[model samples]
Target: MRILFFLAFFISITCHGNLIWSKTGHRVTGHIAEKHLTRKAKRAINDLLDGHSLAFASTFADEIKADRSFSKYSAWHYVNYPMDIRYEDSEKSKYGDVVMGIETCKHIISDKNSSREDKVFHLKMLIHLVGDLHQPMHAGKGDDRGGNDIQLQWFDEGTNLHRVWDSNLINSYGMTYYELGDELEESVDKKKKLEIQAGSLYDWVHESHQKAVEVYASVEVGEKLRYQYGYKYNKLLFEQLQKGGFRLAKVLNEIFS
Candidate 1:
């Protein structure tokens, strides 16, 4: 009884609805985790890239498909949900852990003996992780799993905090990746691009974390979020996606450069 009480207490204090999102996001990203290329691995990627167009070389397709197939898993399906952990007290929450895991995977993908299968796995994982890491809730330090459990109405449809940010916010913009990509590519100055391209995993995590803080400061969950509100959020989402895709491509090119 004492042990059970202790467990319950712990959960009550530490658990959040958003934990599911991090775990699912992590697992999805793990499947596509890229492998570190040796000369051989580099050669393999080179051969693949040589035959494929850069525009078509994203890991997104494989990732989304995997998410679809694995949607039955609570973890995968829960990407839209937030965990119980908060940034202020629980730095090691699943969401933060997911980021760490991605960083580790990034290194592993570069390992010489990692199999082709593993490389492909990390590639997929990185794709998803890149997306997850940019999510303010994934980087959030609040109790609501970045607001996943915050019950709210999204334009008259019932929704939770996390879901609002995960897809709704992005979808509200009505802009496609191609359109956003062109805008981003044109807007980013050469120096800014170099700065973005030059950073390490730590840099990425920190940047996301900072943005997460900004996002949380801007809004509260449970508030009525309509198309206008959604539109505001979508702009941020577009930038994040654009940054994610560009960084992903940069990482791949560097690996195979």
Candidate 2:
């Protein structure tokens, strides 16, 4: 029984992989982006989304995961690069990756000939992928499946590195997406918002990749993460979330402008 239990645990830990950010995090990104949208862009988005708010549309990509047709998009959520390499210098995935996924969605949305249904689908995908792009783990190295194989304990519960960043830290705050988004927005100044939104897509991906390196260095396998771990990384987490929101708004505004 002991051996059987251990084997099961091992399999569970090894198989664990993150689909994307927690729903709360994605909604927070969408909410923040909504706050920054230009008047024209907001009107156009409402029309395209059929009156759905950005927060409501943000999870569409993940919500479609149950459909087999979306299986091809599984790779659209992340792009892995080695610690020593830049994404432009790294090998690209053939199916699609977060970078290509975002660009493709942008292209589809920008094309006037695209049908209303196609624009809506890709725009929802673009919003969600932008949120995913800012998550450090989503930009993690290919080996270890973006740290999914690196198992640890979160206050005595078994978890892995990818899950830790994806949900554990954010959920620990106990705030709804609206509450958290409000707080993050309050903490930033005009200069800081511009700084966060200033980067090109590749630059943003590189930033997240660098952050992934810092995150990997902060914990060890089997380490128990609790208050201290959260405390150390919480500020960084909020910063990334804020940047994602502003950048997403910038992209949408530019597309609709």
Candidate 3:
């Protein structure tokens, strides 16, 4: 039992270091996107992934962090820009960002000259980066390293603004990805679904950047966030997840169908 406890503690500490839309959150995005995939997109994806579900494959980008060779991909997960300027107007990162990542993935996957292995690799990355793109903190200010530097407490436990937005509330809510996804997916009316799926990649990135501005204002350094913070932002969180799903489906459909 002591050995098991040690393993769990080690894992908890290791996982807390990630700056991502937690594994379950990514799975939730993948699940919702699965429900709305076009038949052609589904068929194409089945071929590419060898019958794997998007939920099963969505964590590829984050999972690769464990490997030293994947270091180049680190910057592809998030982007930084000032709140007041448009992304086009802002200075860009030399290492690449979510928008560039999405474009590269699409180009590779859609390239008939590309190899099967390359398509599979980039398709998984595309799914994950799309999910990442919606986690407002991933589109955060450069100075804060996308909220990873803003230290704070999450209900008396030590955490940062980035981790809080990444996994704190969703994990504390304690539902499996499938369970939360079913609940959020059912809440969508047809018209709302259409609206969510209507935006372009450029448009979606800016939308998330705008949300990042608000998320940054939600708390301050050394502040303790608890139930009230959850109550206030949970709705916004759900909205972003829903948008990520619908938009992912839209992106995939445009590519494969």
- Model 1, span 39-79: residue lDDT tens: 55446555644543233344332234323343322232212
lDDT of each: 0.52, 0.90, 0.90
Model 2 off-target regions past 4 Å?
1-17
Give candidate 1 regions above 4 Å deviation: 1-96
* Residue 176 Cα positional deviation in candidate 3, in Å, after optimal superposition: 0.6
Global lDDT for candidate 1? 0.52
Error of 1 at 20 (Å): 10
lDDT of 2: 0.90
Instruction: Give the alpha carbon lDDT tens digit for every residue of 76-150 in model 2.
Output: 999997887789999998988999999999999999999999999999999999999999999997888888889
Best candidate (score: TM-score): 3
Which ranges in model 3 have alpha carbons more than 4 Å from their true place? 1-16
The lDDT of model 3 is 0.90
Which of 1 and 3 is ahead in lDDT? Answer: 3
Ranking by TM-score: 3, 2, 1
Clash pairs, model 2 backbone: none
TM-score for all predictions? 0.64, 0.93, 0.93
